[model samples]
Target: MPPRMSDAVTGPAWASPAGKPPLSSRMMRATWRGLPAKRYEVGWEPGLVVPAGDGSPLITDHYFPRAEGDFPTLLVRSPYGRGLPWSPQYGLLFAEQGFHVVLQSCRGTGGSGGVFDLWRNEAADGRATVAWLRRQPWFTGTLGTVGPSYLGYVQWALALDPPPELKAMVVQVGLHDPYALFHAEGALRLENVLAVGLGMTYQHQGMAPFLRATLRLQRRLREATTARPLRGAYAAALGGELPWLDDVMTHPDAEDPYWRGASTAKAAERLRVPTALITGWHDALADQTFEQYERLCRADCDTALLVGPWTHTSALQQGWPEVFAESLAWLRAHLHADTSGLRPTKVRVHTGGEDAWRDLPDWPPALTGTSWYPAPDGHLTRQASTDSAPLASFRYDPADPTPSLGGPLLSRTAGPRDNGTLEARDDVLTFTGPPLTEAVDVLGPVSARLTVSTDTGYADVFTRLCDVDEQGRSVNVCDGLGRIRATGHASSQVTVAMSATAHRFAAGHRIRWQISGGAHPRYARHPGTGDPRVDAITFTPVHITLHTDSTLILPSGPPLT
Candidate 1:
């Protein structure tokens, strides 16, 4: 639904770009230092019980400007300890901007009731909370939602069939379909899954014994990554709280009915609010974030996007001030029907190598496709080799799988980092192109096609795009992985749709690509028996061969002229 002028301003008396400025044009880090403290005195109302659709009460903390008389509400639904968001940087900051802020802990976390089950319980709880807000005297009947990651997921859950009071939203680094994005092609993201699953386990539980429990859960997660029968590894540590974890282990495939019900995609066309979609290049959910942004834009909603160089956590911390400023500006213009000086650049992305932000007409630009084929000398060239069935072979042993290198990740190691150590492994094969005489600006979608044969009926193919610097250091840019099941064919062709990115490769840098059997603990290694992470005894070495015609598709796009 597109923004309708009649819808925003009625109940509460009715409501509501050019490209954004270059990141370098700003005072740089000075903007972070010089920002004034929140302007209003903050007041908090705690342990407010808001009844849900099931008549269960959810615990909430309401923060408001001390001198306010009925202001717009900024609602943030999160599982992260409810108290953590009541600080100056979160709820209070928004309250100071002439908005009433409510930070509510999702069901089963913090003071709320029920067992927290990831995406399963959000939609009903979110709708109930919004209904509760409508009854509050301080609520001006106009609302906006904000948060990142799981918090952002709540906004998605709520916005699917948002109440008319919902006027705007700011969501960062989250997904519409968890299964589709998290377990792409049925290859589970092991590192991200454990890190987040365990992190969520510890985020809100209280002190003393609970803290002790948190520590135990963390240790169990670390051990589970290396342990066999990964399914029930967390049961002993979590006790009753292990159901959600078990559900994650059992449902490794996408399109599972369990994940379909939790998605916000069903509400895609109904998201009529003015929304700001934010993400980082190195964030693991970059693919989903952009996909959702495009979905909203295509639905004709008033939407904007901002991409940064930060990771999932950094998007909230190091980038909070900017996120705050932009979010406040956006909500004020929408929820209040006040559009003063609001020129929203529809798409804003930060170019990594160039270290500058640009406002684009749209994502995946007006770019042309460029294909590179695998050559005999291990060179990624424009010409395909006709060397008569020439191939590259590697042994993929599940016991000692090729490790995941740095890239768009959510685990222990993320962001832009050197992959020199990773490239040296014998199990990994790399193809490189000659140095570019001039800068090569690449943006949008990237993909890989691999024609290979596996000795067994099942295997996984991991492909990564990299930039090799003039000094011979190769750093991961984007990656793609897919699980393949043999259909009794001699050799099968598999295509992996990679993550999206906007990067400028400087002159003297070479384009590189790496292929391996798996990105371990980040992605579960395939067990030759066809089922993965089920047991230890099924592990076997699979002989894998890549035919000469495999290609890399890069969005080399039209010139910037």
Candidate 2:
């Protein structure tokens, strides 16, 4: 079934007298523990029509507190329709909090009239909505933008040519680079691509259709993911041809003309808006949020960041309380000149193993780089080996590719999960460190430099950082993938940049570094024949060798002497 908006929280609270605020509005405010609502009654104007740049009708909904007073206006543009989650989460909830909220559907979605063309139409359509906003007598002349996922993309689109009324932005589990979303390290991210197709094609159509589509995708996932010549493989699951998905899968190069202007990183570089970013440790776009935070800092834009222990969808569902509080505080600070609720620090992150929140002046506080080398005997040690003897080996078959478990996926299976079964696979290599006598804190970026050789010149290296407990349950922390194209029988040195994290390897726990050829579905399996994975017709098994000189680099809090 399609996940419902009310699944996050429940309330039996009654609405205000005269049924002014509505049951949904009262339930939401009571459900998510956040700032107190400023008003008990909310006025809603549904199905407001606004004109797009090309004269198409953009459907919108307006929400405002009924009490007398001008309030800051927030513009939310979404491709996922203006119902359910969007209506209750953004439209009604924020309205009760004293902000005039404008919730509009993107061109061609919801009731909007036009052809949806992905990122192409957002900017012009956003500006057109703002143009429509300026004409409203109750617009207040001050504006902010707030939303999660693709809704965040539209904010970046508008910031490319920001209107004068724009002041603040809250991007929750946001996306700015479409190319990176589809491909990672030159390989297609097959499952995520199909998930996106399912969302865009069926989600906005409403509950029943979305539930059917989700079930169809689940039933046909394996067939679609393993199909030969995969360009049109997702048609069965997605219900029809999605030309855009086919186009993105075929164009693997980010620099190609097909994706020339896809990234909105430039918007961050030039934006002077006070932006607040919210993401989960396992969010699929957590890396993108980090990149955005860094760029905003370098540009000297007033910014704040909040990282939690959740996933892409959970950042809005399970993590909604913290997410909403942080967003409301930032918006109130910038748009309403109210800073009482703001935190003292600019960055706040949740430490995983310790399960505590840490506030810092900046992300990735200065930390010492610790190197752990992999030994031939399946051990992880600080000491480097002088002789490269006892080379570790494995065989990866594309016909039976390595399965992806958890961590940073867009589905329900995302986030931290036990990796005991995954590590037992013959195709995977693991190096374990001795149980720690003292707690070790890891607070920043994680990377791996490996010396590897494969029988086939074309291959991919999937490296992951895991924490194994006393009972021997291995759970993933962060991981990354890199493709290697080398000459026959020659060793290749490659660096895999894993996702950054703020975690604690508790006392009595061991650290493990895992290496494999690929993580299927999360990333399309390499053909091992130097051919594009989408177009490759032949599958080959590869024998991979790992040398002792490889090391895992971590940003550690204290020296582990």
Candidate 3:
């Protein structure tokens, strides 16, 4: 049965005790009890049992409470230890806003029991955890999940099976298809995979031991300058030899089971709950998020999407306040609770260069007008001229391949910045469009249709959608990459898909398309040798022929005038 909402303006559930003080008051008491009265109190309790599926134990940390009276539940399932500053710092703020916050380590990581194998165990454990939460004494039977990256992935996975008690979700910067993300365009994501392995190892045990081992390895590497010390450090810290790393380094093709296991598209179709999907214009998983929204929209599910000018890690620290407010309002409405008058479908996206937020009823707007520009002499012009021009070509090398200058390369840092320096390199090809006579709002996925051929049998195409101002500074709006395989004399006509964005191209600004062979270490180079092994780095020249029939398509929103 659905829970009933109290009609009172301020029910007993929202009141605080007198004299002894409310939880927030007590928190203040604990904080300023000894020091100056100005110190803020943020109470957090570590290692609270949450009950595993079995009779054993599942432990999670509880952050801040203001006189708990069956408050709504906010669950966060993460591979990273719950004690990490990034997780709890943001978590306590939600508690302060009236919630019973719970942050649990995924099975096989931190204090949780079971072997860790990424998404393989998240669904079952998540189901068990939610079922257990429904029976908790303090639970109001209203629950919602929130997190970014791996934590966000677990929310999506649990929604695949969707517990009856689970109300809503806020998934931030998580991959929809693991294979496409981890092995984009058939190239192994070497750094991402390694970072995940290293992160799990440190979180499984704790940072102390991992830090010691890493320090020792760093010292050894400084002394030896060889790959052996680094390899040994990773092996020791991860507690096992990563044979998959070697596989990724050896196989540049996408026919392996390892790549397939990393994909989450199969699980996405099962998602049925109301979800607020968020991603950054510069995030590596932006493509996956956009694809998931498009797929879920086609399925006719209740889902809203938001794209901002931030990266994966930045969402929590810099973008959380606004995001969390919307998330909480969504949860409140869906759970049949009062939201204090907040709309159900509100989307605010950050526009690059301008750094402003634009609110809309729905993404891609209700009325979308499509515009196609023809490619002549590598220039994108709106006027369709039948002038035949020489094909544009660029050579890609594996050794000193394009370096990843920025744009959603996840690290310990937060926020989205510029990648323009990398975009100006020689390997990248630039095609500019004429300046717009009026402001044009673009919202949704941008795509490029290309009719091309490569001298070699295999190659990769990198495309970036940018906004070039009158001053000639190009800011990256959205980007995508695609790998193509040449089969004999077959035509190489393919569509390069870019990440979705919400932006208003100013009156004097011009739209531009940047085509290249690689985005560097962010996305591994496609060596062009067609070798199945990732470690076999070979360089080959591939002549690309871009036919005049090729066109760039931009999905624009209704006129904002």
Candidate 4:
């Protein structure tokens, strides 16, 4: 056994201001809490240009603790510009707690020179950066990395072939494949992908108007939704061409060879390190985070998972003070092999409907496969429907598709939001369940099995799970989309795998499964003419018919009486 780290490394020795618990606690270690906002003096070293494997100069920012003596180094690589990472209580605060922090701009962003390619160029660049850090006399022999989203992606890319100096990593809201970020079930993620692309364009172009245009999408989303055919609107938003966006528009298939170069699934196969992961229930990458955590644990790696009720950006803010101190504990225990602030391997998730957190030995909590039958007239029941059960039919016109609503959307209003407005659309078909007499705990992955016939061979399937209270307020739980390559007059089975979630439908609350032909701009309308969305400027209306074979299968914990 290793010696316990001194109290100084524990952080409670440093008295925090009144009204707060100890600066750090063991509970925070098990659960992810953002590090506290305590004061500490740190020296900043900006614009430390380093060479990549290809000899391109990568711009980096390094921060050092004032009282440090050859402190361990932490590296963060990003394409979201280096400025925000160095802001107060973020990058600088990491240094304040005794470590040299390095925030680098990947190739083509910030001061780094090269064309900005979305997933490409990260692995080689990350490897070169870590190698350079090891040779620096100012950096101690140990090195760890931290960052979120794109920053998190870079860490997985490096773990594919980590250097000996790389000891620990902290990845938040990351993906194993680029497809999870832009494409799902052969459908383009319209609004979210465009925002990311436009934001990237703004960063590269650095134009005030372009930046404003990106922000406008969020501010006047309803107005922005008016832009037609998607391709033209996204291009217009940037006021110019964005190669990354162009690639996504052209390569619509998630399994295409084009994405092979950047898929983190390849790296996940070789991952071997002490890793800490944090995610949010409503986050777009929540499912992927859980999948990655499961993979790591199966490999016998030291991994911890934390899922809270937060959006992509607000994930760390869920419990900021406790998280900050917990983050420090993660770094100390992993890098120095210290046991003082040790944390166990477990899964901690936030139950949305219940609005509480659960610590379990593993995720997917021994869920039973429960199937809810779709009653076209409106009801979800466990008892199989009779042949006399009426079939629900709604005409799906591409010209007027159902609009986007709250779900795991990245760029728009994400998290749990009222869906009453969206449910009123004529193009959407709703199947409701009777008000439950007892609370039902719905946990883990959800999938829908549908039997449907369409007038046209091509169509789209959009499904949503919502909780409707007695007051008549409907809020989104989880949703997913599946594209029908071709359909016929005969009923065909189509399956849509909704994202995973941990929610409890309280007593008196009704469950809903919304069936729609399209979610409009968020997912491109199936032109109904058999052409792809890129050429979907003009589309023909197709009538869609849904039959009784459709079922919403939810993974639930204990069977309800």
Q: Pick the candidate with the highest lDDT.
A: 2
Give the candidate order by descending lDDT.
2, 1, 4, 3
Best by TM-score: 2
Model 2: clashing residue pairs?
none
Q: C-alpha displacement of 270 in model 1, angstroms?
A: 3.4
Better of 2 and 3 by lDDT: 2
Question: lDDT by residue for model 2 over 413-476, one digit each (tens)?
Answer: 8889899888989999999999999899998899998888888888899999999999999999
- lDDT by residue for model 1 over 1-561, one digit each (tens)? 112323233222211001211223222323455344544544566678988788777888776655524567888888866644324455656765567788888888887888787887788899899888878766778888888888888888888778888888888777667675457687777777665665577667634444576667666655666667666665565543466666766787666776667677756575788888889888888888888877887888888888888787777767776666667778878876667635555787888777888888777687776888877667888887675264787888888888887777775377878988988887888999999888887888889988888778578899999999999999888888976677543678899988888888888998898998998877877876666564545687887788888989898843343
lDDT of 4 by residue, 75-126 (tens): 8887766653233444566765667788888888887987778888888899
Q: Roughly what TM-score does model 2 have, to 2 decimal places?
A: 0.94
Q: Model 3, clash count? A: 12
Cα TM-score per model: 0.89, 0.94, 0.80, 0.89
lDDT (0 to 1) per candidate? 0.74, 0.87, 0.63, 0.72
When 1 and 4 are scored with TM-score, the better candidate is 1
Candidate 3 vs. true structure, TM-score: 0.80
Q: Residue-wise lDDT of candidate 3 within 1-561, one digit each (tens)? A: 122222222224323221222344345334322221211222455666766666446677665343424567788888777654434334555565556678888776787776666567677788888877777666788888888788777877777668887877777887555555457656656456555556666754655766764565444422221122122334543456766444444444467665555555654565667777888876777777777777677777777777777777666556655566666666666664765735545566776555687776766665454655546555677665474343576666655566654555565422333446766676777778888888777877777877666777677777777788888787677776777777743447778777567678888898888777776555656666765424343566565655566667777753453
